[model samples]
Target chain A: MIEFKDVSKRFGHTVALDNFDITFAKGKITGLFGPNGSGKSTSMKMIAGLNRPDKGEVTLGGLQPQESKISIAYLPEIDYFYPWMTIKQAAGFLQAFYADWDEAKYKDLLGFLRLEEGMKIAKISKGQRAKAKLLLTVSRRAPYLLMDEPLSGIDVLTREEIINTLIRDYREGEQTIIFSTHEIAEIESLVDDVVFIEAGQVKLAGSAEDLRINKGMSLLEIMKEEFRNAN
Target chain B: MPTSRLGMFSKLYSKEMRELAPEMITVIGLAVLAYIYLFFKTHDYPFAVIGPVFMIGGMAAFLPVISSFKLLSREWKNNTVYLMMSLPVKGGMIMGAKLTALLSEYVLGTLIAGVSGFLLIYALNPELGQVLTSSIPGIGMKLIELWPQGLALYLTSIVIIAYIASISFFSQMVGKLVSRFSGLVTAVVFIATAYLSGKVGDLFWLNIDKQWFTNGINTFDLNVINQFLIINLLFSLALAAVIFTLAVIIYNRKIEL
Candidate 1:
């Protein structure tokens, strides 16, 4: 379980997260839903241990990321792999750091994504790089998978493939996945719960099915309504 | 147990060294190539006389700073800090491995220049054993012949690179800690470091007995010169350790972006 207890963060005078409190439970696909400047990426980065909260704490499985980094696999919103690395070298690099790295899973994902091992990350297309990021994250058997904006800047079919890969390869009751995306419909069917945030505050959060039933609309519609009301 | 843990960080060091290979190879290759060009151009001139200066002092000017900037700025510039920071390793280890790889590059560059310079000396004069304690006035030959001097010089270089890289990391830390006027803060820090650099840099050329160590070069006290160089190298290394520790603390607490 990942928990943010009264956590707050700031960049200069601007507060990125304000006295925020939330927890992504074990074994659930959660979406951090928010538009740009709404603190979605900030919250995700905090969870992945990229940013430290100025106030309060963030913990996964009752430990800080610095203490339990081996158990978390994070795919950031931006391209994060070295440009000079080939797909194979990139995988090998991860294999060295992570004890739970699954070589077979990596190979399978490479095949599924139609990516070759010899492909240089720098030379690859943006869409291909996205797939490479996904493969690298999923190939780890980490208990917590934090993916920030994993679907941004990809085409329709590639997004579909990623969604399919998530659902198909998801290890229920074993791996917990939290992904942030503003495009609600892209991950609507996949995410079990949703956390709606805007301007550094959580406007709405609950099980996806519960939100839909209570609001009498799709997650996308509820998202629009919630942020609009907050504004 | 500690060895295995270090092995993991060593793997990172190796990967970083590989990434640095291209630039390192280029500098060494170019230095050697330039030496060859100069040698050919001045066939009638003493190849051994000016070759060492062009290779060591000339080709290597400002290389430590350049190499440190390239190694340390990589993650933030490429957006790979996310990957780097997320790895199951402490910030110190990450920084250490990176510094080590960079040190390897710097050492290798110096070695290549030194070796080629030595070759030119040998080609001109086969009796290389006395080059270190040459009756002739040759600072370059003294460096290659005296192991203590060579090692002291190399250690000083390692410390220099360490200091530069640590300052760069601190700059990132300062930027994240205070986003407003970050540019101004960085500039102030850079200027401050530059101001103090000369006094600190004198550690590399520790000539307590100026004329005895340099000047005609043959009238130097071996014991005194070696001891002074050793003291300077130790001082530089300790300062580097402090800077690195501060960098690690800042990285853990305040480094963002």
Candidate 2:
């Protein structure tokens, strides 16, 4: 399980996460839904060991994120691969760093995502690059996968492909995925649990189905209702 | 494929070397042009090439320091710091690979400049070449006798370059911890570090100076010179290691992007 205990992080005068506390259950796809500046990305970064909390702690299975990085696979929202690398070359480079990098899985995902091995990262379309990022990330059989805004700025068709890939690759009892995004409706069916956050605090949290039934609204509509009521 | 620690390090080192190849190639190309120009000018003024030859040698020594300034900063510029920081390796491995690659560049650059200079001087002015290659007659030392001193000097130069590269790494890592005027901070940190290390190095040299002229003899002893050079080399290497370790700590604990 990944735990964030009373964690608070700030940038200058902006409060990114204010005494935020949450726990993402193991082996479940947890949706971290929030609007802009709601600290969704910050939460993911904390779990990935990319950001440090100013107060309190973040741990993965009793170990700090830095100590357990080998068990976590992180895919940031921005493009992070080297521009000079072709997809194949990037994979080759990354394979050396990750012991869990599955070449067969990578090859299968490359074809499924329709990404060419020879495609230069700099030359590829944004949607294609998104797919490439997903391919590299999912190729590793990490216990925890933290993907921040995986669907943002991607076209609808590309987003559908990504969602489909996640559904296909999720190792039900063995993997935990924490997805942070504003596109709640897109992954609505895939999410087992949901946490709606506003101003860096959990506004609503429950099983996806339970939340829908209790509110008699879609996950997207529930988020709008909650934010509107808060305002 | 499962990657061992050494295997991963080799891959990282190769990546750094590849990123630096363009600059290395450009320097080599310019040096070649300079050498070719000197070859033709040799007939007009035999000793005219001396200045340009030394200038090339200086450039070879200076290029890696320039390269070192960019090695870490460019990762942020390219947004590749995300990929770099997320890797499950210690801070030492990442910076170590980069340091090794920069040192390799220094070695290759200096060798090309040094060897080419010797060949050009030997071909254009054989008498000067003989004087340089042969030992001092008054000292009664042969060329073979001076080999250890030459080797010590070469190794010391390598250590000095490595130390500069480590400082560059340390300063750049410090610069990245801020939001504004990062480049200026890097420049200040670099200058401050270099100045402080030079002062510290002087203290060690002072102690060496006492034993430098052994047994109250004013004559130059090759053994003492070699000993001094080795101590200098080890001192610089130790300092570089210390600075490099500090940079790694900052990288692992403080840096966020």
Candidate 3:
């Protein structure tokens, strides 16, 4: 679980997150949906302890984000690995820091993703690199996994592979996964909860089915309608 | 089982050093080739014997300084700081790994250079050892004569080198802080700080000499030299520590995009 308490972040004159307050519960797949520059990534970064809020606090479970960092795995929108490192070396490097590293699961995911262990990450295509990053992240078996735009820029089949891989490999009872994506159709059926953000604030958040039943519209349709009304 | 923090730090440093191994080998090879060429061309130049040593040692010390600069800059350019910062490791630990790698490269380079220098000198001028033994008493007298000036110069050089390294490290830190504007700002700040520090140093030295004018001029006191070296060493270490601390604080608190 993660909580942001009146957290605010600013860049020069522009506010990236404005007094934002939200909580994400555990043991569910949560879809964080928003247009570009809607503070979705910022919120995720704060939760992962990669970025500090300018004011207030961001907490994971009962501890500060940094204190809980080892328990959380983060996949950024554009993940960058050490260029000189092979996929295996990268995984091994990560394995040292994390107690929950599952080597068998990592190998299985690598095979499923069709990623070569010896290939340098820099030599891989963007889609393959993204998959490699996902494999590295999910293999950690952390209690909370925060992924920002994991499916973006990948081929349709690769995207489906990624989605299916998450569904198949994710341990449902104890683990929680939160991902932010603009591609709602790919993740709509997979996510149990959804949080919609706009202009640095949470506009709508609830269970996916509840949003459909209460709003009387598909998640995408409601998002479009909300943005249209805001403009 | 989890690696201890220091063990993790060492592992990270080892990885960085391995990444830099190709460059290290190339530089060392080039130095050896140059030493051989110089030996063949001008056998009399003491450098024919010592050249390789100094070249290698200098490169060992200098290359890491240069390589670390490049490594840190490239991380910023590639936006890899985001990934590095997101990891569970402490900010200071990340810096420690980098500094350890750089220092290890420097030490290894120095050793290669030193060994090469010693071997070449022994091979070329085997009689140099006899020369030193015979001249020891006279050289001791000469050293006593020049002890004060020699000590001052040696201490000053050490201080200057430490100052340069600290500035370089600070430049990398500043680059991270300013991001896109890092290069321009780093140059400007480096120049400005260097100029200001030079002026302040001149003023401080003038006061020291002025206060102890007669003693400074008349005292060939070996004790004076010892004192000066001790003070210089302390000053250099303090400055390095402050710069390193600043770097750690910025790294720990500042968010990477």
Q: Can you give the DockQ of every candidate in the order shown? A: 0.52, 0.78, 0.56
lDDT of 2 by residue, B1-257 (tens): 67799988998899899888988998877888888889887867878888888899889889889988777778888888888888889889999999999999999988998788878876788787467568776676767667787888888888888889989989998998988899999999999999998999888777765854563234667666666677777998999888888888999889987
Best by lDDT: 2
Model 2 misplacement above 4 A: B209-211, B214-218
The 10-residue segment of model 3 chain B with minimum total lDDT is: B135-144
Q: Please, what are the lDDT tens digits per residue for candidate 2 over residues A193-212?
A: 99999888888888999999
Measured by DockQ, the strongest candidate is: 2
lDDT of each: 0.79, 0.89, 0.77
Q: Write the candidate numbers in order of decreasing DockQ.
A: 2, 3, 1
**Higher-scoring candidate on TM-score, 2 or 3:** 2
DockQ of 1: 0.52
The docking quality of candidate 2, as DockQ, is: 0.78
Residue A208 miss distance in model 2 (angstroms): 0.9
Error of 3 at B213 (Å): 13
- Order the numbered candidates by lDDT, best leading: 2, 1, 3
Model 1 reaches what TM-score against the true structure? 0.88
Interface RMSD of each: 3.5, 1.0, 1.8
Docking level for model 1: medium
List model 1 lDDT by residue over B42-154, tens digit each: 55655444645454644554565666666666777888888888888888888888878777776777777877776665555555556546654633344455676767777
